[model samples]
Target: MGQGQQEKVATSLAGTVGEEISASLAPVDAELAARYPGDPGTRQPVHTVYVPGDLLTADTVRSWGDQALAALDEHAPDAASLAAVLGLSDDLAGPVHDRVRAKLRQEPVEDLRVDFEDGYGHRADAEEDHAAARAARLVARAYADGTAPPYTGIRMKCMEAAVRDRGIRTLDVFLTGLMEAGGLPGGLVLTLPKVTYPEQVTAMVRLLDAFERAHGLAPGRIGFEIQIETSQAILAADGTATVARMIQAAEGRATGLHYGTFDYSACLGVSAAHQASDHPAADHAKAVMQVAAAGTGVRVSDGSTNVLPVGPTAQVHAAWRLHYGLTRRALARAYYQGWDMHPGHLPTRYAAVFAFYREGLAAAAARLARYAERATGDVMDEPATAKALSGYLLRGLDCGALDLAEVTGLTGLDRAGLEAFATPRRGDLTASAG
Candidate 1:
C-alpha cells in the first residue's frame, strides 16, 4: 500500500446526489423548521399567581408582596426559622431565606392571572363584564405606574358549550378595556381554560384574530395559554395527543400549556385527598404536555397546591414544607413554572427556586466554561448540553436566583455570550460547533 497508489479511491455517487436529496426533502425541511422552531429565548416567569377577577385591584401586586412579608414576619420571623420549617440545608438556609424576603419586598409575583373561571366562579353577565373591564383598567394602570408583575392577564372560562358565550364576552371586554385604557400592556397574557379539543384552540385563535383586527393591531400580536384541565386534552377519542394538536391549531399563538391540578385530577376521578401536582396522574399529564410543547416555543406550567400556609405556626410550617417540596421536585423534572394561589406561597416559592438554581450554579458554570473552552473532563458534553447549561444560568439570572456578576465570574461568559450559546438555531448549534 504505497502512499501514492492508495487503491485509487474515488467517489461512486454523482456530484448532484446531495443536491437531489436536499431538493426532494425541501418541504419536509420547511415543515420541520416551521413546527419545531425551538424556544423563543424569552424570559419565562418562575410562577404565575392567580387572583380572582373581583379581587384584582391596581395595588394587588404590592398587596400580595406585603401580605407575603407579613406572613414571613408572623410565622418564620427570620431565615433560621424558615430554614428550620422548610428543612433547608445549612449552606442554603441563610442565602435562600434572605433572598426570599428581599424578593417579597421587591418582585413578589413574576406572573399574575386574574382568574375569571374557577377562581372567580359564576356571576351575572353584567357583573362579570364589569369585573373584566375593571381588571383591564387596573392592570393597565399598574403597568403605567410601574407596579405590575412582569406578566399579567386573565384566565377566561373554558370553551365548553355551557360557558362559551360568557367566556367570549369576558375576553372581549378585557381586551377592549385594555385598548380603551391606552393600549394592551406588553406583558399581557391570556389563558383559555379547560381546553379539551383542538377546535377549541382554533376558536381562540379566531377570537384573538378578530380582536387584533378590531383594534388595528398586527396579526399574531396576541398569544394565550391553553389550560389542560380535561383528560381529553391530553388524549383524544381518536387516540392522538390532543394537546399537541391544540398547539398547532393555535396557529403560533400558543405560549403555554398550563396544567389545572384539581380539574385535571377530577377529570380522571382521582380522590380529592390525592389530587396534587406531584401525583402520578398529574405527572403523566404534565409529561405529555412537556413533550408536546418541547421545541415549539411553548412553555409548560404546573398547577398549584390547594394547601395554604396559614393558621398556627405548625400548620403554616407543614404547608410551606409541602409547597417547597413540590416546587423543588417540579424544578428537578424540568417544569420551571407553576401556579401560586395564595400570597403565603410566595416565600417558599422563591426559596425553592433560589435554592435550586444556587445549589447547581457552580457546577453548571464549570461545565459551561469547560464547553466554551473545548476542554475535556469527566463528563462529555455537546452543543445541546451547552445550550441547556446556558439556558439554566439565564433562567436563574432572569428570576434573580443568580446575579450577573457571579454568573459572569464563574462562567467567564457575559450575558451576551450566554445568550449566544442559548439561542442558536437547532441545526446551527451543531453545524457551527468546533
Candidate 2:
C-alpha cells in the first residue's frame, strides 16, 4: 500500500455477525456495568470507634480525644518515647508523633458507631428503644453543632431469629428519630451485625427499602455494613463463598463488609487467646471479603483488638506496640480500616496509619509523577500501577497523613488529576495515558 493509501481488508464472516455478537452480549455488558460499578471515590474512614449505645454521649468524641492525649502524655510523652515503644526510626518518630497528636485534637474519631450489638448486649425492649432513639438525637445534634465525627451511626442487633424483630425495631426507631430531628446526615452509617446468610442481607434491603418509602426518601438512600461474624457468612454449607452472595443480595445497598474478629473466630472454635485480627482464620475470612468486594463500590473493615492500653506504663507500651504492629500489617494487606475499641488505641491507630503512608509517600509520589509525565525510570509502571500509586497518595491525603501541597509538589498533579487516575473507568484503563 502507498503511504497515503489505505490497505484493503477481507472479512470471513457476514457483516451481520458483528451486530449478532453485540446483541448476544448486550445482557452481559449490562450485568458487568451493574455488578461492578467500581469504587465510589469517597473517603473511607481509617477506623471505626465503637461505643456501647448507652455510653455514647455528645461528648464521646471529645472524651476519646482527651483520653488519647492523656494516654500519650503519661505513657509516650515525646517522640523518642513513642518511637521506643513502637520501634519507629528517628526520622519517622518526630513527624508521626506530631501528626498523631494533631489528628487526636482535630478529628479524634473518623467514624463512630453506637453499638447495640455485642458491645451493648441484649437489653429489654423499652430500654433498647430509648437508647436507639437517644443515639439518633445525640448524633443529629452533634452533626448540627459540628461536633460529630465524619461518620456516625448505630450498629443494631443481628438478623438472627432470636433478635430479628428487635433489630428491625431499633433500626426503625433510630431512623425515625433521625428523620424527626431533621434529615439523615450525609455521614450517617449503619451496620447490620452477625450476618450469616445472604437472605438476611436481602431482608435488610427490604427493611431499608420500606424505611425509605415510609420516610419519602429516595430509593436506596440507606446502605449498611454487613458484619461477617459467623462461619456460615464466609463459607456456606455447600462450600461456596457466602460473602460474595451477601454482596449481591444487598442489591447495591451494601456499603461495606466488616470482619467480626471475635465472633467469627469463636464460631470457628478458635480459643479466646487465639482470636485476634491477625489470626489465620481472620486473615482467610478477610481475604475472601476483600476479593468479594473489589470493584463493587463496597469497603472491607478489619475487626478490633480487645487488648486495652491501660495499667502501668510498661503494660500500656506493650499493648500499644501490639496494636501498632497489627495496624501496620493490616494496612500493608490493603485493609485500610479497622475497629478501635478503646481511647488508648487512638494514638497508635493514627501513628500506624500516618507512618505507613509517610514511609511510602516519596516513592509513590515519584512513581506517580513519572507515570503522569510519561517519563521512564528504573521502574516502568502501567496504568494499573499508576492507579495504585495515586490511590496511595489520595488515601494518605484523605486521612491527613499527607498534605495536598506536598503531594502536588512531589507529583506535579493536583487532587483532581490524582483522583482521575485513582478511579479510572474500564475504558480509561486502556487509553489512560492518552
Candidate 3:
C-alpha cells in the first residue's frame, strides 16, 4: 500500500510541473553552455615543455627553494630551477664550468627531469638504492610542504627489467608512504624509461592498481605517462600496436605519452655516441607518436633538446637555437607539447605553442563544417531514427569538428538525442559496467 502511494506521488509530481519545471530548464541550458562554451573557438596549443631538473644538487635545490619562498613574499611568482646542465663528456679544459651549472639550477623551470645517467651516482643496494630513497623524500618534502617547483615528476630508468623492477619497487615504497601521508604535494606521474612494449606499461598499471587498492586510496588514482624511447614504440605493426594495447589495458588510468627522442634514436643506432633529442631521427619519432595518438585523448609531449646552450644572455641562446634549427624542428612536429631542460627555453616554448594553435584552428573549422553537412543529411533521412545521425554527430564531437549545441541545433534535438546511439530502445545504458 505504501509503495502504491509513493508511485502515485511520483506520477503526480511529474504531471504537476509548472514554475519549478521552467526554473529547472533555465539552468539546464545554462549548465550546458557552462560545460561546452562552444569550444573557445579553438584551444590554445599546449606549449608546456614540462622541465624536469633531475640532476640538481642539494645546494642547488636549496637555492631554488630560497628563491621560490622569497617570491612568495613579493609580487611576481618566479619560475623553478632549471634542469642541471652537466657536460656529457666532462673532459674538462681551461677553467671549471661550475658557474653554468650553478646558474642553470638557480632559474625556476616548470617541470625538471633529473637525469640518472652517468654522474648522478648510484646506490649500493642496486634494488633499494640511496638515490631512489633520497628522491622520494625530496619529492615528498617539496610537494608536501608546498615548496615544490611549479610542477614535478621524475623520469626513472626506462624499459630494462632491472630498471623497471628498481623503479617500481622504489616508487611503490615512496608513493605508498606519500599517499598514506596525504599524498605528494600535487600529483605524480612516473615516466617509464625505455618503453619497448605494451606489457611494460601493463605491468606498471597493475602495480599502481595494487598499490592504490592496498593504500585504501581510490583505485587508479596514480597515473603514468609512457616514453616512446625505443624503436619498438614507432613500429606501426609491432611497437605502435604494443603501445595501443597498453593504452587499452590502462584505459581510464593513462595520463599521456612522451617521445624520448634521444633514447629512441639510440635504439636505431642513429648515433654511435649520444642521440640528441633535436636530431632529425628524433623529429620522425615525435611525428609518428603524434599520428598514432591523433584521435585518442592521450596528450603527446616531445622530448627535450639535448644541447644546453651556454651563457645567461637571451640573445646568445636565441642565436644558437635559430642556428641549430632545434626549436623550429620540434615545434613543427605534430606533437604540441615538448620538454624543457633549461628555464631559459621558456620563450621558445611559448612561441611554438601560440604558433601551433594559430595554424590548427582554421583547418579544424573546415573539417567540422564538412562533418556537420554529413550529419544534417543523416538526420534528415530518418528524422525519427536518430541512430545514424547521433553516431555521426558524436563522432564529429569527438573529433572537435562539431560542438554539442551546433550538433543539437542541426538535429533539432538536445544532447539527450544521442541516448539512442548509446543505448537502444530496449537497452538501458546503466545496466552494467560491461
Give candidate 1's whole-model lDDT.
0.93
Cα-based RMSD of the predictions, in order?
A: 2.5, 1.8, 15.3
Task: Put the candidates in TM-score order, highest first.
Answer: 2, 1, 3
Candidate 2 ranges with C-alpha deviation above 4 Å: 1-14, 430-434
Q: What is the lDDT of residue 73 in candidate 1?
A: 94
What digit string (tens of lDDT, one per residue) describes model 2 on residues 72-116?
Answer: 999999999999999998999999999999999999999999999
| Model 1 bad stretches (over 4 Å) | 1-9, 428-434
Comparison by TM-score, 2 against 3, better one: 2
- What TM-score would candidate 2 get against the native? 0.97
Q: How well does candidate 3 match the true structure, expressed as C-alpha RMSD?
A: 15.3
Could you tell me the lDDT of residue 34 within candidate 3? 38
Alpha carbon deviation, residue 72, candidate 3 (Å):
22
List model 3 lDDT by residue over 1-434, tens digit each. 67556543334565448777878889886654333222112222232333233444444445543543342223112222111121112222111122223223443344445444322434444534555556666767676655555545565555466655656665666565566555755446566666777777777778878887886777767776777876777674543455666555664566667877666776788874557766678767766666555434466776666555334445434433442255445545545456655434443343333233333433433333434344443223322233333544453443233456755654444555454443333223224313
Structure candidate 1, residue pairs in collision: none
lDDT of 1 by residue, 1-434 (tens): 87787586788899799999999999999998899899999999999999999988777888999999999999999878888888888988888988888899899999999999988999999999999999988898898989889999999998999999999999999999999999989999999998998999999999999999999999999999999999999999999999999999999999999999999999999999999999999999999999999999999999999999999988998999999999999999999999999999999999999999999999999999999999999888888889999999999999998999999999999999999999877786767566
Better of 1 and 3 by lDDT: 1
